[model samples]
Target: MKESIISVEGLSHKYSSSWAIQDIGFEINKTGILGLLGSNGAGKSTTMNIMCGVLNQTKGSVFINGIDLRKQPELAKKEIGFLPQQAPLYKELTVDEYLLHCGYLRQLDKRMIGKAVDEAKERCGLTHFSKRLIGNLSGGYQQRVGIAQAIIHKPLLVVLDEPTNGLDPNQIIEVRSLIKEIAEERAVIFSSHILSEVQLLCKEIRMIDQGKLVFSDTMDAFNNYVAAQSIRVEMDRPPAGEELLKIEGVTKVEFLTARSLKIYFDGDHEVTDRIIKTSVHHDWHLREIFFDKNSLDEIFAQLSNYTKSVN
Candidate 1:
């Protein structure tokens, strides 16, 4: 088994009377990106703060490479690099200058700061823009500078909060590629409201709603879970919901549009065959029929809505 680089157990936080997060726990045991997903006030920031040692959790513990965060704050933090939603940058400083300053702040030896700065710039594709002032660069380039600063000390884990929040489509693509490049040798924990971006970048996902974890699983497992329960059908003249429900394995039928239906059913391949046969028998002019697996966006909306209704 791979050793866990970071372990969070029973993590919780409260502000005065209201709780910000509750009993959050997870472990990163390998080099891969872990995505944190949630809505506007879903405690994503609180959780990241605790993990990065910005705010101590009201309860529970965090371990980075077997070192307790509370017991050895400096030692634990030495292995982490963090970039919040807003990239921290001094507009007047050049990329190289800022990275060198970061290396110094991390207490790197004076002799090693220049080499570390050069490597970080190379890794982030900032070597060409090394002498340009940060404020004069594009948003994508500035974000690269932020990431470069974060990794200047070569930390074992990097935490990023909404790294691609406000970029153009091209910039989003560029930054996403950069994130994958950085994750090649270390673990990355990032939070984003963009489901598609998370899907593209992360193998494992942790979704939170109302300060509570609602789902945590690998992307493949999540897709399989959705696929086992639903099927989508499109036809020129679709049958009634009542008629579709009468199919052998179907449990419910939802109309997406006049020509489309979403059918919920048991995980039986035969159900699909039955649906096709029924459409043919009715001369429904079937256009499409396939499993109605929920995308990560749909799943997030469903979970967040459920949390709101219950609360």
Candidate 2:
């Protein structure tokens, strides 16, 4: 089995009496991308801070590559690379100088620092811009430099918070591709409020709401959750909502248009066949039928609302 790069257990943090995060826990194993998804003030940054040793948690333990963060902070932190929402850069420094400084700061041996800088620059596509001043690079190139700095020490785990936050569409695409490329070697924990981006990049997801974990599962499982609960039927003439609800196993019907209806139902393929047969018998012109899978945004909204209602 692959070794876990990071493990968080019962992690909680507070500022004064106000809790920033409560009982947040998860593990990153193997080489793949995981997403921390939440809205503004939902404690993503707080959880990240604790994980990266920037803030001590009020309770619980964090282990990076099996070293306890609270007990062996220096050793634990050596295994992590973090890129905050705002890219940390020295505007006056050239990309090469900045990355060299990062390598030295990470305590790489003088002999290894040059090799590390060269490798990071190649991986991040910054070789051509190595001599250029960071203040003169485009937003996308600057972000690449930030990423290069994070990986200069070859950490086992990378944590990126909203890496694409300020980029334009083309820049977002470039950064997204770069993130995926980096994850090919080390585990990555990406935090973002952009639902589509998370859906696109992450194989697993952990969603936070009101400072608590609301959902944690693989992407396939989340997709199955939406698929198992809903169906969509398109007909030339849709039945009335009451008539559709009368079908056994169907709990609700939402009319999407004059010809399309979204049906919520318990697990019963028989009920779907019945709907098809009924449509055919009534000359309703059944045109299409399929499961109505919820988008990540829809799932997030539902989970957030449920969290609010429960609290």
Candidate 3:
């Protein structure tokens, strides 16, 4: 089993009588990216703040690398690097100066701070603009500088809250690539409202809604959640839904527009073969037979609606 680097047990938070997050439990393995997904006001930020030691959990506990956050706050926090939705930066300071200051604040040895600063700059692709004031840099470069500061001390976990919130399309791609490159070593806990971004970047996804966890699964399992075991059969004459559903291993069928029938199988490729055999037996001219792919956005929406109904 993979060792869990971050663990939460019955973690809950509230504001007066209202709950923000209730009974949230999950584990993030080392060296993997976890997409902490939720819509705005879904308590994703609240959960992240609690995990990073920015806020005390109203109930339950958080463990970072086996160290209980409540019991050993300092030790647990030292392993975490947090970047808020707004990447807090010293506007007047140059990128290098700010990063060096961050390294020192992380308590790196005087001799090592310089080396760490250099590494952070290079890794974030900020070396070219090292001497530029953070306020003068473009939005993308400023974000990079923000990342450099967060990783200056090389913590075991990096938490980014809406890291690409305001970036242009090209800038978003650059930042996403930077995040993937950074995740090669440490575990990354990222929160975003962008479903496609999570699908493209994260290995595992934790979806939350109205302050409660809705589902947690790997990308493959998530795909399965939205995807029916269906084969898209293209033919000269599209079969009716009921007619196709009657085929062996087929649980359901939907007419997707005109010539495409999404034939849902009860199980494996055996159903696909059955569909093919049945189609041939029916004298239906088959053109193409392939699995129907589900987009992450559809799955996200379905889960969101389910959460709302349960709440």
Candidate 4:
């Protein structure tokens, strides 16, 4: 297997008297998008901050591309590019000026600052906005500038914290595309509380809850593990709600429309197969059927309970 790009082991942190994150550990591959998922105040920020060397961890370790973050802060930081939840921008500065400043902050050679700034601007679709003041640009463009600064030094691992927060739908789409494009060459850690965004863009997921690593797995596995307790089916010729309830493992039925309904099951996913068979027998003419993943609250609660039980 290829060596990991980001390695975190027993990573932890405390704020004042309370633990913010505890025993969080995970690894990122060299290329692709990995989602750091959690609710607000779930310690996602603390973990990202520690990994990016912006905040210190009280216990554990973070290794960025094999360099110990805490031991060699400068060297380790050279391999990382970070965007906190809020985009750091000097509103008065034009895109060009801000990027040049960032290049300096990254300690790029004076001779390379211009080239690096241009390249970052081009990659982030900010070439045309180079002369525009950071505050004058739309929220989407400002976000692009933030991303541009993060990549000015061309780091190996980019950690983004809630990069899509508070953006219009169109802006969010544009930013998501930019992130995917960026990940093609380097590892990207996209953090968000939105489940659908992670489901749509990530290859793997590391979920934190109540300051602990509650779930870690591939995206497909997560889909399968959390879904199927409920399913929505649309049929051209549907049966009465009572008739459908006779199937084993079925718990409840919710009618959504004259031709559609949602089915809730206890545990046996085979209940879907049975429903299919029954539909065929009754000539219900099933048109569409798919399992519905639980709501974010449901998944969080379920995972939290499981984690506590394991501990």
Highest TM-score: give the candidate number.
4
List the candidates ranked by lDDT, beginning with the highest: 4, 2, 1, 3
Per-residue lDDT for 148-223 in model 2, tens only? 9888898999999999988899999999999999999999999998888888999999999999998899977765
Model 3: residues with Cα > 4 Å off, grouped in runs: 1-3, 227-231, 237-284
Query: Using Cα atoms with residue i matched to residue i, what is each candidate's TM-score against the true structure?
Result: 0.87, 0.89, 0.84, 0.91
- Tell me the tens digit of each residue's lDDT in model 4 across 2-99: 55799999998988999999999999866999999888888999999999999989999998888899999999999899999889999999999999
Encode model 3's per-residue lDDT on 112-144: one tens digit a residue.
988998899999998898888999998998999
Runs of candidate 1 with Cα error greater than 4 angstroms are 1-3, 227-230, 234-274, 283-288, 305-311
Worst 10 residues of 2 by lDDT: 220-229
lDDT of each: 0.88, 0.89, 0.87, 0.91
lDDT minimum window of 10 residues, candidate 1 = 220-229
Candidate 4, residue 191: the lDDT equals 95
Name the candidate, 1 or 4, with the larger lDDT value: 4
* CA lDDT for candidate 2: 0.89
Answer with 2 or 3, whichever has the higher TM-score: 2
lDDT of 2 at 207: 90
* Cα-based lDDT at residue 6, candidate 1: 95
Return whichever of 2 and 3 wins on lDDT.
Answer: 2
Q: Please say which candidate is ahead in lDDT: 2 or 4.
A: 4
- For candidate 3, the 10 contiguous residues with the lowest summed lDDT are 223-232
